[model samples]
Target: MIRLQSLTYAYRKGAPVIDGLTVDLPSDRRLAILGAQQSGKTTLVQLLAGLITPSSGSIERLARLSFPAGYQRGFRMASTLGQNITFAAKIYGADADEVIGFVADVTGLGAMVDRPLRDLSVQDRMNTSFALTYALPFDTYLFDNTFTVGEPDFRAKCLAMFEARSRTSGMIVATKFARTASQFCDCALVLIKGQATYYDNVAQGVAAYEQSLPVAQPKPAAEAPTGA
Candidate 1:
């Protein structure tokens, strides 16, 4: 279980992106965080991952958490996909060969596993990244719109991977896609204007979100001004 009390953080003084946010995350469940851009979703994840300390709150966790972001093949674009996965496994102190084989099977990278990251498609890159993270034995996983970076079929597989992980561990995913949240998450947290509201069900959260959108004004039918 993870507990937060009076969590507040900001890049600058007197202005907090996450303002006094306090909530509890149940063990072994999937939670979807819904928010517009710049709504502190990533910041919240960072805090949870211990990458950043909250300015004025307490966070207590009973398990290890892992976050997979900032993953890409740039300068070392020549490294094979399998090599990248193996590197991550080694960092986590797992058996490299077993990890590679397991992730390759789970991600369906198969033959492409030995290919360089630069040679892989966008979908393949995402698969490799997820497989690398999932192969580690982290108690909690935080994903920030990472699963949506691939093709539909591959994205489905990524979602399945997350579901499998949630069976034994906790997961908190931040995404703008309501459909993704509705399909995968058991609970939802809607963040609006720096405030976080928890929902017991995803459907209710989605409905509330849809209702909060500004109604589109109907275009007036084109008409000649009456003889004015």
Candidate 2:
């Protein structure tokens, strides 16, 4: 279980990104975080991942957590794919070869595993990142729009993997894709201007977002340009 009690944060004094936000994440539930740009979605994920400290309040975590940050793909270019994954495995004290094999099988990174990371395509790099994260045993997983970069089939596969993992561990996914979120998430958090409103269902979340938008008024046709 993950709990945040009166959490608050600010990059500049008196200008908070997350302000006294409190929530609990029941284990093994897939939660989708929806918010417009600058709504503090990424900031919330970072805090949960322990990448940043909260200015006030407390966060309680029950188990290990892993966050797939935007820069995780850079690890793919650090060395051979196998080498990078093995390094992570060593940090976690897992058998490197065994972990590599399992990741290769699960992520379908067969021959690509042996190749230098620079040679891999964007999809392959994403696969490597996911493989490394999934190989680790963590109780909570935080994904920040990583699936948006892959091809359709690969994206589908990634979604399946996330769903499978969610059956055993908690997952918090922050994305702009409503359709994808609706397909996998058990609950949705709709954030507007840094304030989060809970939505028990994805459809309700989407409807709320649509209702918040101001309808566009059509512009009158421009008069014919004066004779040049």
Best by TM-score: 2
Candidate 1 residue lDDT tens string, 116-209: 7789776567666776677788887888865544667756766677768788888888877788788878888887777788887889988776
Clashing residue pairs in candidate 1 are none
lDDT of 2 at 132: 68
Candidate 2, residues 98-209: lDDT per residue as tens digits?
A: 8899778866787877788888877677666776676777787888765434667656766677667777887788876677578868787777765677777778886776
Runs in model 1 deviating more than 4 A are: 69-83, 106-123, 146-148, 223-228
How close to the true structure is residue 107 of candidate 2, measured as C-alpha lDDT?
A: 68
List the lowest-lDDT window of 10 residues for candidate 2. 67-76
Best by lDDT: 1
Q: After superposition, how far is residue 148 of candidate 1 from its true place, in Å?
A: 4.5
Q: Estimate TM-scores for all models.
A: 0.78, 0.79
Cα displacement (Å) at residue 122, model 2: 5.5
Q: Name the lDDT of candidate 2.
A: 0.75
